[model samples]
Target: MQLGDISVNFVELVREACHKLNVDPMPVLNEYGVTPETLASPKARISISRFMRIGQALISTANQPALGLFMGQALRISHMGLSGYAAMTSPNLERAIRLWIHYESLSSVNKRGSSRFYLTEESGVAQFYSISPYNEFNYFVVDCLLSGWSALAHWITGQERLLKEVEIEFEAPPYAQHYQQAFNCPVKFGRSRNALIFRKEALLLPSIYANPATHSEIVSICNRELTTLVGATSLTERVKQIITPMLQGREVGLTETAKQLGLSEWTLQRRLKKEGVQFQQVLDETRKQIAETYLKATDLTIGEIAYLLGFSSPAAFHRAFKRWFGVNPKPFKDQHASGRTDENTATGENT
Candidate 1:
């Protein structure tokens, strides 16, 4: 399955964490082709694989394994963008959480499926879908999400330690103790699901930022944005479809792509800009997604895959693959071949 992309807002959070740690994040950000201008764009996004590489880079630079926890603590409601605004204006925490979940695609896209919320009369369980075959590169993703939700709940209610308990899908790492400190509750590892358990009554608490009229207005705005997002996604998908069959040891430039789409190069650029993406960004993302699928799901040799994806050479493909996933393609393919799913084997560098 093709992985999805995360909003550039997440890159900002990583930058914030870098500042808190007194580590300069520019070198790493630049290495990933992210800039202040890119982050300023509300529609900018990074592929999930690329973001994982960034997280791994930051963790190494800061020498901090628990960076995701720090990031989670730094999360503010406004960081979530429109989905956050909708939640902030909702009349109660329960409705706020539901609204946020419903509109989450506005901020990030996870093709595995969005997080799920199961509400009972006495309790509510907020479950994060597993992005499993866990490794150091990805465990922090779960950490940031589960703890970020806890932090958001506390922020909305003006209360601390709102979770009854936390459950993680993987075994406890060496930094497992930090999970408890982060959540301020019993955290069970090796559980069937990654979830936050909460008191249903607590969910009924009125949001500190709640307003009936403002919520109505924000929900209306979110609806419009969601519609726009869907339309923009269709455009991106069309571009990807055209780019796919063209990559065969040859570069697919924007002009060529525009010709294929029956539009002038300038017109194509304008449309993509309206969708919050550049032509080059779509091309690169398309290559990364296809490269990953080829490495994971086929017996194609590295040179063949590289040729198929239009890389100049196998060595060049090696460099790009490392840049995309923070690992050499050979090891990644080998890991999958051996069915090695242990989180303990994931050291962030090679995983």
Candidate 2:
């Protein structure tokens, strides 16, 4: 799946980790505009830059170069929400990891790359690797991710996971001793990759929470959420996310959308072009989709719906709706209002 922005809950976890170290997270939270409301809601997102600023603040405040390592050790299964539940309820550690990896994006924004587990039978080792983007938070992101994986495994099986060795891509930090304490294993820095090496046999351990029936049910929910999140990962979906709310208030344009996404208008255009979509095309489609939903489901007037959709006037909305559906709005509403049960008339075009 394509990587994109992260969930605000991960930022909340970072703040929780900071609090564990007796660090006050407010100053940085205020500076970056991450409000209590943002942290309170798991579905909210913090842009990549804002997330890095939080990491920077935690490190600066705690004066711990190995803050990420300490933070990783602080992870709890409950912090991951549905994904955590799905993982723990899996039949075995290996299946649990698969569940975790599939829905991990529900926990964090994964812009650099998605995570994966690799099993090497020859060495009887399973490797967990996180692709780190080339940013200041690269090490911090990977540290928390890998360590959190180890932490989750330990929590699920109620057993200690003595990693074979922990390999890090970055040079050893000044407080490197913390790595050994965090991972409870030898740590190697300046390695070719960042991965946690462990015995493959660990994958066979039965989870105390495992229930095949429950797992199957929760898996369906996870898959649905995965589809939604994956859609939000695309450039077009990102734009629509921004445009949807903006439309309720005022006209949303490319410049404003690009600004919210932290990209120059042209850069956003180029990327969308690569995906074979135009910015206006995305905006119009979004408006049309919402317009149709409002027309069908709500008793709101045509003028009210037009205004809510950011159209300057009902006439303009009429022209656009006709262009999209090849019919006027009044007749469409009248069909539904008159108790006409024909699917074609209710759909506004098929008739």
Candidate 3:
């Protein structure tokens, strides 16, 4: 995989934007080598830099201010390869999101389960929310997701109701104003989260093709991408990024995990594979070793250790630890302390 490929996936949004705006924007995608042919395939995955390039094209062409409008109009079913799958397998807008949450990352390996699209009923209104929290490619993720959220709204209902609001945590700047009309709704910035909101009734709307076999094919394709995602350095970098922060609540994404080292994520993956190890195995093995070291050499609580290893809960940590060492952490800690006492007593007698 190359940056060009990843960029290509994101370019789908730009491509649609150009079409909706009636602007010929081929040169932007062409500059990065994202072709119509490459995009037609749902399983094709690409690189980060190329996606950035495509984003630049939109930023330039749409005028930085109108970027959101360009983006909002760009998101659609045809772009996500969900034309058949979203309609059939999902049963409704809600179920379709469940599939999308699990499978949407497959459209481009760039996201890899770091985003969301849903309708939340709260505060006297049903709200639609879309998010991309786990991505290193924030600009690309936000742009792609905002557009997809907008597109999904149209797909769910023939009405083409725009998003209720789009919120981002980034600094409020010249880039913020353009999104206002794109949503044909409200937009908020410098907020606590990055997400898009809409009405709840949108969940009941369905897309064009609701067929089973085609949906299964889409599932199969996305599954393969998910499997390939494992052991890749991208996975390793994410683990390290998340783990480092959980340990210190410091900037974990800042240090290169051998994945964050490059402008292109695929390059990091290739480099790791050349080194004879996949990111997933390295992450798991590293965590297990670290957990053991923490258990034996430190007095940190089990909860802290679990969080340090990036597990969501202590039970998860214990299970993983047992699987790795064949012993629970409490017993392991006790045994280490006992050994330390024996050695200390022996040293005292010698003295």
Q: Estimate each model's TM-score.
A: 0.69, 0.63, 0.54
Cα error, residue 168 of model 2, in Å, equals 1.1
Model 2 residue 155 distance off true place after TM-score fit, in angstroms: 0.3
Quote model 2's TM-score. Answer: 0.63
Which model scores highest in lDDT? Answer: 1
Q: How accurate locally is residue 341 in candidate 2, as Cα lDDT from 0 to 100?
A: 22
Per-residue lDDT over 1-351 for candidate 1, one digit per residue giving the tens place of the 0 to 100 score: 244667888889988988999999989988777778778875677767667778988999999889988889889887899889889888888887888778877777654346878886668999887665577888888998888888899898898757889999999988887887899999999998899999777888889998889889989999999888677656777788677667777898988889988999999999899989999999888889878775764456788788878889999999989999999999999978665221111011221
Q: Could you report the Cα RMSD, in angstroms, for every candidate shown?
A: 11.6, 16.9, 17.1
Tell me how candidate 1 scores on lDDT.
0.80
Ranking by lDDT: 1, 2, 3
- After superposing all C-alphas onto the true structure, candidate 2 shows an RMSD in angstroms of 16.9
Worst 10 residues of 2 by lDDT: 342-351
Give one digit per residue, the lDDT tens place, for model 3 in 75-133. 65665564325544555555666666565445543312245554445411212222222
Which is the better candidate, 1 or 3, if ranked by TM-score?
A: 1
Query: How should the candidates be ordered by TM-score, best one leading?
Result: 1, 2, 3
Off by over 4 Å in 3: 1-7, 19-23, 35-42, 61-65, 82-84, 87-89, 110-113, 117-141, 159-164, 175-178, 205-351
Q: After superposition, how far is residue 86 of candidate 1 from its true place, in Å?
A: 0.8
